[model samples]
Target: MTNKQLQVLKQQHALLAQFIIRLSLFYQGYSKAIDEELQTLRGHLGSNANFTLAHVSINKLNALLQEDGGVLRRFKTDTLQSVEGAAKALLATSGKANANTSIIDTISQARRPAESLYDVTQLCVQTITLYSQVTDTLPKPVGVAVKSHSNEPLQAPATLLMALQEELVQLLDTYQKRLPDNTELTILKQKVVEGLNNDELLNVCLTLLRLIVKDSMQEAIISGKVIQSLHHSLSSLHQGLNKSIDQAHCTFAVQQDDNLAMRKELIKLENDVARSDSFSALKTQTQQQLKQVGSALEKREENDRLAQQALSGQLEALKAQVAELESKTRYYRNRLAKQVATSQTDPLTKLPNRQAYNEHLRKLLDNRNINEQSLCLAVVDIDHFKSINDRFGHSAGDKTLQVIGKQLSKALDDNDFIARWGGEEFVLILPGLNAKSLKQKLERLRTRLTELPFKFKQDRLTITASFGGTCFSHGEDPDAVFERADSLLYQAKRAGRNCVVTDKDDV
Candidate 1:
């Protein structure tokens, strides 16, 4: 070999070895086996490296790369399967949809061992968008906007999912209030509001569904009873009508018989008079016939009077039956009304519940002249409430809630509204209050809560709460206003509880 060619070959070998070491370092921590192989390859290429050693390490790295490629292929397959499964679940829950039928068909017809993940990914994205559009059309809760004061960015899917959850929670609250109070229902609703994850949320929703079914069944039973009562009343009315009809027919036949007998007596009298030769005989026959006619007429009058009395008795009975049925109907109707009111009422605090709050907020937002009116919303969370519950019994906690609810209600104006949002939280809607007024009002309430004399198990304690409030700006989103207010409330929470945070000046 020529000296210059040999020197060029050595330089090329040195460059190749350096490249191999760099490549091995790049593959570090991919897998334990891969890492170990790279480590050994690095050692072989270190300080005292030669052409044969470089060849061996390069071959080993190439084999490891191939193995990693297979793993990547498997990962891709698993991810596609997961996506397909998610798509199926969406279809199952959403029911049949004609708009996405082709997409669905493509997914269903795809081979078990997917040929292309890219195609699957595209289809999945389209399906998800379809579902998103449908969900977006659902009625969103009033005062739920998606602006957060956090560093973490909120993705569209996550935000939509949260909106759906809020809607669901609101729906459950509505149902819970309109029905009767239940322990299980209350617990599930609280968990849902407190932000249970999606998997746990599904389980909670199922439980809530069962409760709703139970309530529906109860309502059905009540309706069935009402129907049965109506049916029985109608049957009685029918029987009364039939009996009156038969009585009328019997009276009619008796009257006809009496008339016929009276006619025959008169005719016999006339024939006897014609046959009589002496005037005295005629007079006697006439007298006897006239007496018989009088007796028949009297009997007919008595029969008619008795028949009238019998009819009067039947009518009275029917009237009593109708009155009783009316009274029962009225009673049940009133009971149902009471139940509806009860459903909207929080049993613990005897205040309007979250369902009531939702309705109230909706009305305010929907008002035609809402822009002119000053509307303010606030959230009050009792500081260290869980601690109270943990230390004292639930009864104490219940009492504490009741006292605070009443005090807060009393502290507000009559036109203002207050409700038990859930647990140890309360919501207030103060109309005709501007930002400055809102801040002052909230501060006053915060102080008032601390002043409340609370005693639990012979231990005197002072209770306090944190407040977050925001006023609705003209043409601003009601939900955005609410979100801003809620964010402030948490800020208050973070700033040592028992304080008021508001977007009064900012708004």
Candidate 2:
């Protein structure tokens, strides 16, 4: 499906999942409340087992509900488990109570409606607890994925990929512009874009997607820590808001009570003045009381205003701190991304280094075997690579290697992949092909390389590579196969440089 269709499906699935979870929670809460209420009723009957069972079950359920996440289908099953556990706990808790049947019978004769009402109150608390659990576990199963079955991997269309690539370039340029001193993340992003520039992975989109996910995962841990800091900051802000609200409520309640008492006092004073004709004394006393009340109200208002101002300042400070922590976290995360790039990348060729080659080989071999398909491995070594470095300097040698790397990458078919095996040596993985065809393909690549020359200082330098081809067998050890290819490579070198060698040449 297209992105929009996929998004729509995900939204629908999430809605359904949410609805189902809500229904399950409602039923679970209702059942638990019933069990707790029954436990209370049974308590009067002198049976302790039933109430204890319900208590344990409700407690267990509450624990699970308090947890961060749970699988959707596992929810109803968990609810049932809690119910059964409660039943079992009740039976176990009441075993001793059942033994004293005579005492139980005496209590059962005197159960009251008030006790029942108290039981109902306990049930209400349990129901509230269930609601809390629902809120906590809410937005549960956040992802609802839709999978498709197609022989070919689903890929972003070429136009979309090109647009995305351009957008990414613009975004990175923007980031570089904003954070000029931050070289680590900027370098990594450039390298990532460089890797995606190849037509092979971009055409399929899966490899690019995986690379993106890998990069995201690398930073996600740091991002998660930053998020935790924000969470704590938000919690503090929430506490401040709650405190301010409580203060306002307390202030209002106190003023209300004081005003009511003041009204009573004024009424009594009015009656006394009417009976005794001491209107001046009554007025004086009433004014004094009113003045005192007004003073207290003013003081309370001033204190409240000051407290609110302080809380607001503190909340703002907390937000700013969170922002600073996030920026710092990104710095560390960028450093980490740079470290990964250096370790996995070949600095000289700007390609996947030896470790990457090994990893890719293993994955490709495993995949080929699983599919029972043929695979081809070619070991390419440049002819007299050291002589070029010695004669023209390492700069010339480096330029040649770079040109070769680009040519190798571009010359290969979409299904083919190339990796920098080691210094001056490259490994190619060609799936769904055998040794005979690999030789021909490498010969063509060799001819193509000889035709294209690179400028080195004042000289136009031509490069040639020797190919050692081998067919991959399923379930064979990767090292052993690589050793075989290496041995063939030596044979090609010995026979003559710039030539292809395979098992047929062994004779």
Candidate 3:
């Protein structure tokens, strides 16, 4: 390949990396919104059952409409109207209720489709735009002879661009077709179409760095803004989700309180009836009154049971939502790692950039809890990293790090996590492990590293890594534990580098 073609390929690779990062971030937001929505739907379903019981009381009140010349008709009508109004109120507050029931069937069903669409769209857009930018930046023809001899075709860039556009168009069309026919869907589709045709299109065009030479950077210039627009659209979804959940919670609480109040009132009414003494020849009337009250109590008890069942179902649904959210979060994390590696990671070694390591450490500290089980942290640093880098250049340095990361990861159990801590440095987290076991594991890992020979450019390079480990031991704070491990790592470095060190006090 000519220098120009190589340059174009590099530019394309960079764009692709950026696209992936943006797509992953967007999907993360979408997933979170869906989770929140699912939780809200569950809450709404619980509230609906509670309100249904209230409607039953209203139905009983409506029965009085048949009383002749009793002025009951108006009261009954008013009660029915109140029930209708309440149903409408419930529907209005729960966004999921507004969706076509046939399409989603349940709140849980509705959430998945919408969330999946969002993620798919984000990913597709990122992929295509990156591809387009890369193609557009192909080095100028140099000379016709050079271009022809280099096996570069004249129409490849245009063909690739058209293919990308077609892909995006198809994705959007498929998404729209899947949405249930509704005003919301219509509005969403219109917004998406407008974004694609206007600012988003312009941004895609500008991203082609070659367009800069033609004074047409409009697409690249607006790409960031288009991304922001997409972000705003997603943000609106979360707001709607939050409102639904809030309303559901409020309705449930109110229904519970009302049920208790009704029970108390029924008891008071029964006591009043029992204490009365004005029924000389009205024994039958008193008996009838007692039967009616008993029936009402029984109905109330049944309603309470139904309401409780609904609430329990809602809680289970919320748990499912939380689980879904966790899964989505995992996906986002993996996507982020891929994106970061493409851009900032040592391509050969596939190790975390310095920035990523710092972020990882912060996350570890933030997520740690006092009551959590024992946590073992190990820091491993290569013994002679600089010598390898000097002898074989940066490429060999990368391969060494990648091999080390792979070995370390393979040596640890599934519960353990290993990440590139920094240049030639690695960190591992082993949960539910005590200090002694952690030490033994580290020693074994060290031994394995000593035994292995890393191959690069037809030469075998032997390497050793020093390990320092400390355990949280049930009650210790994360910061203190990390500090101890770090100090031990320094100790290992001092004690001839290829060894494992633990806190002396613990030993």
Candidate 4:
């Protein structure tokens, strides 16, 4: 053989070796990608129970990759076995068309390794696109369920997968762009594109298979069986891919529904809590109002008790006064019957004359029963009465006496009756009153009278009175009570006017 021819053959062999190496690298890279994807899915499955759809998709992908690998291995073995036949056919071909036909036949019949690799790559691409669309259209169910169950969102996995898919598509695009556009490689590329086409390529593949068996003169053989098997494998891959897509879609839908339901429930719960809060506030307010009402009721009860005590004391005092007045009426009637009739009562002041006061006291002592109630008498005389009469005339003095008389009446109850005993001096009788309350009532009356404003002509005048009181609890004679009260009056006149003094004690 010539050196140039030998060198040409050596160059051809070198090119073939380079093509095989590149194909092997391609296969290795594809396998690694499949392995990595499978590992990622396995990790997800193990770590997350919610990744059921992903687990199933990964299992299907692994199975598809395994089948593809088997197909590729078979193609490699068949191609090696058919290499000598291909070379012999190439040498014996009479025209360029025949040589091309021979090469095409060899490729068609020898189980092309690139075909399975192409299928695997397409599967990977389709799977990634399906997952991406699923994730984009709805949230990842695995991650959503994880977050739902664990109360933690898992955003990293979906983000990483998106980035990886992008990288894979770029890598595939780069590899496709880098491939040499030689005639044989161009034909291979066309075949790949054709294989991706659903109907036309399938018909061409069937025709090629039929022609091969017909040329071999194999009679009564099912030529369609081989096509059917390829169809079955393609169908399996398609179905698996479609199933994975459906699963991803379903998972996404479920997660969306769950999220919506959770949100609705949460909103409802919040509303309920708000309602509860309103109710609680209302209840609290009601309780406060009830407490205020209860407090008001307590205060009312206390006031009622005080009023009841005052009324009871007043009622007892009235009963004693009625009894003493009955006895005094009898004594006065008897004295009037015995004495000469005299209109000695002062009409303006309603006070008894000095003669009448002396006669009444003597009768009271003479008619006194052993069981008769004791008398505590006070003589209240208005101070500076004569000066009042001089300064404001007789009308002013008469008004002053009337005011003092009214004040004295107001100070005494029925139990302690007051009769203007003589002139400005009023006399009082207590049937059963203790001196302390009686004295306090008298002092209050004195204070009220001092505070009163008496109008005389166009002028306002005020007056003060001095009071002398004595209790005759054991004295059988009214004279003794009178004398004691009179002595106290003199002592009050000596000490100071407009003051109350008792003969019994410092009342």
Per-residue alpha-carbon lDDT of candidate 4 for residues 1-507, written as tens digits (9 for 90 to 100) = 999999998777556545533544454554555656655554544423335655575576655464455445543443332332323223222235544444434433332234543553443344334333333444345643333356443342323332222222222222233333434334433453322332433343344334433322221122234335446555655565565566556655655654565566556555555666577765665565456556655655665566556556655655555555556557656655543223334455654433455566555545445546555677777887757755776457656777788777776675446565433567766556567865776688779889987777787777888888877666545555665776687677778787888864653
Question: Who is ahead in lDDT, 2 or 4?
Answer: 2
After superposition, which runs of candidate 2 have C-alpha atoms over 4 Å from their true positions? 1-291, 358-377, 390-395, 413-417, 429-441, 454-462, 469-481, 501-507
| Better candidate number, 1 or 3, judged by lDDT | 1
Model 1 residue 448 lDDT?
94
Task: lDDT for model 2, please.
Answer: 0.59
The TM-scores of all predictions, comma-separated, are: 0.50, 0.41, 0.34, 0.30
Q: What is the lDDT of residue 398 in candidate 3?
A: 57
TM-score of 1: 0.50
Query: lDDT (0-100) at residue 344 of candidate 1?
Result: 70
Runs in model 4 with CA error above 4 Å?
1-344, 352-368
Model 2 deviation from native, Cα RMSD in Å:
28.4
Q: What does the lDDT read for residue 180 in candidate 3? A: 41
Taking the tens digit of each residue's C-alpha lDDT, what string does model 2 give over 240-328?
66766776687677667766766776676566567655668777877776776677667667766876786687677657766765776
List the global CA lDDT of all models: 0.73, 0.59, 0.54, 0.53
